[model samples]
Target chain A: MILDPDLPLIDRILAGEQNVFAELINRHKQYAYTIAVKILQNRPEAEEAAQDAFIKAYQNLAGFNRQARFSTWLYRIVFNTSISYKRKNNKVFQSIENTVIVYNHEGEVSLEKTDKTRYLNQAMMKLNEADRTALTLFYLDEFSLDEIADITGMQANTVKVRIHRARQRLADELKILLNHEALTL
Target chain B: MNRLSQAQEDILLEYLDGTLAAPAKIKLEEELRVNALLRLRLDELRAVHTIFQHASLAEPSRDFTARVMQKLDTAPSPTPSRWPIRNAIFLLIGVLTAIGAAALLIASGVFDGSTSISLNDSSLPQKIIQQEIPVFTFSGKLIINIIIMLNIVVGWILLDRAILRPYFQRRMQA
Candidate 1:
């Protein structure tokens, strides 16, 4: 039968091949962690949330209907778990000045890129969690609008609006941040 | 240059995403040719896109996958029937015990009209003030009734938490 690769693994797991689940975990962990980090904005918490999500996926494997791709379902779990962690922690964003970005001994362009990346991260913190997550998944170029809607529990139209609005706001924030930097120097 | 409207900015974004229809794309291109401000806005949005293109996924710790596998091995299967069923059994037992005790007390006549407690019956208040305090007497039957009512409420809550909610959650998932 023609099934997505994950469906076979899922069938095997359902048939009592438990260790086969590890391959599933390895296949999906990066995007899962990325979704977590985007929502939680804390590396340690994101890691914990991602790990918890994988465990949750494993536990609920029996109930996973194959209507959606496995990655979509798993990322939804990651998104929800990260959101719950974010709520539990109620963490404030770290100050931009305190953020550290390390690059190898490249040239001045790398230094400038690092600074821009740092400023972008700071600008991202200014957004509310939903907006940050919406923009992040949009830019990741991995999921379609429908998949993003499923992951974030937003409507497709809403996700579209949010992505545009978030991008516009990020542009404004980046402009302000760069202008402030120029003034300080 | 005049500030662009929100609609205008949305059009620019749509154009950038290449989702603008051919007619609208032609119209926007015509506008961009004459309008420096719209072009400038497009450039700013393009810059944001460029920055995002440079963005990459943050890698989890080296052991992230291993950690997930380890956790999967150790964590119990989150079946609605397993832990929640056990918890429901314990709560049911507790509720049954409470109802049984209340029934036993009632059958033994411990809550009969003759048995009661009074606040003024204590000697400490009289020893301190040597005055007749207002007597607040409650019958054992009343206290037992209140206790039973409270137990019923608490038992309902426990049963809901332990059983009904989990059962329905699994049903919805299915």
Candidate 2:
């Protein structure tokens, strides 16, 4: 028999072990939060979405099929939760003008680093929902194309194209922020 | 538009990242030698990829894990007592087992023993002789009655195992 962690975790859950659920939450919270933050672009909302997803996952643990990886199933829940949160919050796309950009300067390197991160975050915010999600799952979370496809319910080819397009858009946005029109193509 | 073939561009990007195999690397190098635009595009993508790769991983709130578990703890779940179907089935099985056992005892003549008072109009001596006969007789009927009682007990045991045990087990497991 395969000693899969998810299987044992499910068994433990069925055996009236609630701590196993907690262990699962801790184990996958970072990845879940990364995806949520990338989509919602707000710390509080992302954290809330991640929490909701884990709770929902626990409630529906018995319905989990072993055919799919536990992480993939969790990703689906996180994605749906974040999207639902975004809708419920009535957050609409406004212009990207309010976005702040940070640049590196010679003196006070720490402030410059903080500013750059802020600018990167703002740039990330400017991306569309799908692009942001694709970029985060592929680059930040280090998910493979197939895994992204499983999570997003998209084809592998579609995931690849989305990542490519998202990267291109981010590069364009970054260039605009930097005042450098240096794209080779 | 004039552009590099998609395959060639993909290979070029992979090669710049040093992710291409040796054969693919040699092939891409040959192609890059013949194409200047492809080389420029590859370099641009590489620069962008490098920058993005260095982007920091956003740290969530300090109490992220605690907050998540806390939320889970507070989420409302449906009450276990709301399952009327399960309870109804259990009740139905219990009643049926009781009825079936009673019917079996009646069918096997276990409860057919007579309880009657016969007044003898005879003299005192005759009455004494009649009293000598045992009032509660135990013959083959005793064994049959014992067997019928044993069957009912077994039925009760089966009912407990089949219906009640699983329900309690599920509750405990929950």
Among these predictions, the greatest TM-score belongs to 1
Candidate 2 C-alpha lDDT tens digits along B1-174: 466666765675567557789998887788779888777667656655766677656666778777766776676541223255456557556756766776677788877775534344335577367554434544444555566577666656656655676556445445
Residue A105, candidate 2: how far off, in angstroms? 18
Off by over 4 Å in 2: A1-3, A92-123, A140-142, A179-185, B1-8, B16-22, B76-174
* Docking quality category of candidate 1 according to DockQ thresholds: acceptable
Two-chain DockQ for model 2 = 0.12
lDDT of 1 by residue, B1-174 (tens): 477898998999888878889999999999999999898889888888888877787788988887777777777754433565687769877986998899798889888875435556666745576666665556788788888888888788878766776566445444
| Candidate 1 local lDDT, A21-55, one digit each (tens) | 88998788888888898888778989999999998
Give, for candidate 1 chain B, the lowest lDDT window spanning 10 residues.
Answer: B76-85
Give Cα distance to truth, residue A6, candidate 2, Å.
3.1
| Model 2: residue A138 alpha-carbon error in angstroms | 2.0
